[model samples]
Target chain A: MSTFIQTLHLAWQNTNSLLCVGLDPEPTKFPGALANRSDAIFDFCRKIVDATAPFACAFKPQIAYFAAHRAEDQLEQLIAHIHLKHPALPVILDAKRGDIGSTAEQYAREAFERYRADAVTVNPYMGFDSLEPYLEHKDKGVIVLCRTSNPGGSDLQFLDVGGRPLYQTVAQRAAEKWNTNGQLGLVVGATFPKEIELVRSLVGDMPLLIPGIGAQGGDVEATVRAGRTAAGTGMLINSSRAIIYAGNGDDYADAAALAAQKTRDGINAYR
Target chain B: MSTFIQTLHLAWQNTNSLLCVGLDPEPTKFPGALANRSDAIFDFCRKIVDATAPFACAFKPQIAYFAAHRAEDQLEQLIAHIHLKHPALPVILDAKRGDIGSTAEQYAREAFERYRADAVTVNPYMGFDSLEPYLEHKDKGVIVLCRTSNPGGSDLQFLDVGGRPLYQTVAQRAAEKWNTNGQLGLVVGATFPKEIELVRSLVGDMPLLIPGIGAQGGDVEATVRAGRTAAGTGMLINSSRAIIYAGNGDDYADAAALAAQKTRDGINAYR
Candidate 1:
């Protein structure tokens, strides 16, 4: 019932972890009995959640992965399963949606009311009003995309807006103006440790959902060194394929649990 | 089965109209017997499509509206209905999705394969690779956001990236580099007639999906003048709330048809 930040802080303290296990269920890569069945999307993710919850501070399910397979029912089931089984950990639906004010309200409803996620990732390309509807949900977390993990993210994100880069401007605006309800966070890719440092300095201990570790080849030590707050706890470092698709056999769940634990400990070492 | 451009040209010639009827179904705005049924999303959209098909070159269903009401099933049915009834008119899924390459593939599958849309809108903020998956669908259309109509869109869109603005950079790249398969277009809001003119000059006859008409109060005369190609058929001028919600009684469908015909003829006059 607490706000997303409070829930995240509690999860971090209780689990002693900062790792956010990402559920990007691609059926082509799914193993064993779970390969092509639409129902297995939920079955596979539920097992991973059961296995990895001990080591994660949060769970982020990328909406595109489920919607691609026409398994939105399964996505709903998975989020409900997480809330029921793992009550402490917040679920951040990685949708990255943006639109004008009227349509953005619908997207906000889909994420918070339908899918029941504690937080949702959104794109900032449409600017202030596009994000206002999500921010109106005072208790839910609204994380804005700053610097992305992919190489092409530099296309517009790194453009010089005024003096600093566009992503820096995004971080500054998100922290100063958009955080009216204290529910805003920034998605800073771990690959760009320097940008992470810059965003961290600009936001001042606000939550940063750092992707691009593990499978994306980001240096974790450098990421933690740059992104961590003075108190050493202001990020949800996400690992998707590197953890969930870590193995291809029946033992995939165990492999995922092991991967999650190692990554959690790896993040903890610097913190 | 012709390419998207060929199909669009055919539709433009056959319909003799530039209006694109936008389906943004808000249940709260529904009338009479279909006020709150989840099935009404499809029913209302189907009725609107039937009434407006004679006056439209295309139909655009904004995905957020359906997802907000847990009506993705209805969205699928509505598209199928459009194809069955009005085969000449292309359906553009206005999703505005952007992500990394691998994830973008999932989103591309969702829009093109699952939804069976002739085209889909995308955000260009992530640059080349994020859009590559969608562009890879050689036969389908890929429309990228350039200068949006919303005032908040100016926040990052108008920032000077190089010599001009970020949107111009987007238009140039979309035309020169990303139009490899001849499946590229840009979204320039109808509200900004000058920017539409600028984008039209930059992209040189590539299709422009112009929204922000009708309820958004965009000047149709200026929009058509600024966006029309030398051939006088290169734009899909979209009108959402103003046409669909023209009446709230059981006569809503008749009112919508009247509005669609008026708008279509008005646009024709300018073209």
Candidate 2:
């Protein structure tokens, strides 16, 4: 196993949970302590990291929230702060980037070399060539979008490809073909429990980052049951908005930690 | 006509050229004059905008380059500078962002509302609903990825969808169903001149953003000939690295302007 997998396994063992607290700090939903401050996003993320570092196996930072703001330095500070607060907890940058060959290589450098993210979310629309650069980082994880947890995700993902849904083909290819470096993972949305079950079956032992849990209204019990691997080890249940914005007052961090614990307990209930 | 279309038409009349310079400034490719400096990107873009503003009909900034750095401020500055320098020049934010409803709405706000781009590129993988938010801005152009200009683009794009290649189906859908607001355009790679011809036939009057021109080794002459609408008003030939990095020295801007002129002349040769 690669360093990322080892780190992930170690995290699970240490936390006694498979929960990944998604650090998607939306500006409007920031706590009162940080509401009108210039460093609101950074402060909120720092507190969340400090509060939930013991419970979360990993932290997934959605790139869109940071990208939406003009204060990019704050994003870098947030990542740096996370690393300082929880040195061992893996930071997955949920950017969902995809592009052609050389351009993709530059993006890989930006994400891994510049930001030092342990892993990243990628869109596979441009095919395997776009993913080759990320795969070169033997220690980093490349999570490809499989069956997303959204209403329109079925539009193209469910399109017939050789008498099977395109997502199934993506899953099989990711498991057999794309995981050559042993650093592959799939972003399976928890909203579609049946699809999650199908993908879990298709991709035997690969790690799965299952999002869409809380805010998206995914059935936690059904998703956890459907997403577990045969070894019962390769799953990361992500809860973003629901946990981050659990409270809008000064006790937001405590509320976030409690919300994260509840999600972890919910997943454990299914397990 | 929409604001984007009107801007392009006016730009064509003013410059007497149909060239659209693609501003994709990779940090690694920055000259020694601006080595490892973030501010260099803004300076590079401003110079290019000033040098080629009078020669080109529009400017296409590939969002991936700016997004790679997650430099939202730089992108905003770049767009603002372009509008300030060349007030009537349409800025197409080449960001192939496509997601489910709410997420798509956020992306639309980022590209159109926050950045205030005249046009934006989008992926059609998630289908109509993902693109609806973009199309709602009827005065701004929404360029859908139809037939990309990359080698592996055919892997999924050419897949048989209901007994037809997916690109053809995408073209048909864009032309018939998705073009309700008349704010649609297609991204047809310049490398595939034949596919360009086919897509042009499908999307009769809609504008086409043709990339893969200079550095990607696309045949500019054939692309312009096969991709242009019958009225000769539908193609936006984009050449990124070749024009921007035409010379690696202090004379880069002048060389880029000359390179833009050459690309424009090359496209006009076939026209």
Worst 10 residues of 1 chain A by lDDT: A29-38
Q: Which candidate's lDDT is highest?
A: 1
User: Candidate 1 residues B1-271, lDDT tens each?
Assistant: 2288788999999999999999999888899789766588899989999998998999999999999877888999999999999998999999999999989999999999999999999998788999999888889999999888888898878888766888888899999988888898899998899999999999998999999989899998999999999999899999989999998998899999999999999899999
Model 1 residue B24 CA deviation (Å) reads 0.4
CAPRI-style quality class for the chain A–B interface of candidate 2: medium
User: How does each model score on TM-score?
Assistant: 0.98, 0.94
- Give one digit per residue, the lDDT tens place, for model 1 in A80-143: 9999999999999999998999999999999999999999999988899999999888899999
Per-residue accuracy of model 2 over B183-262 as CA lDDT, tens digit each: 88888888899998999888787888888889899987788789877667688888888999998888999999899888
**Which residue pairs show collisions in model 2?**
none
Task: List the DockQ of the predictions in order.
Answer: 0.82, 0.53
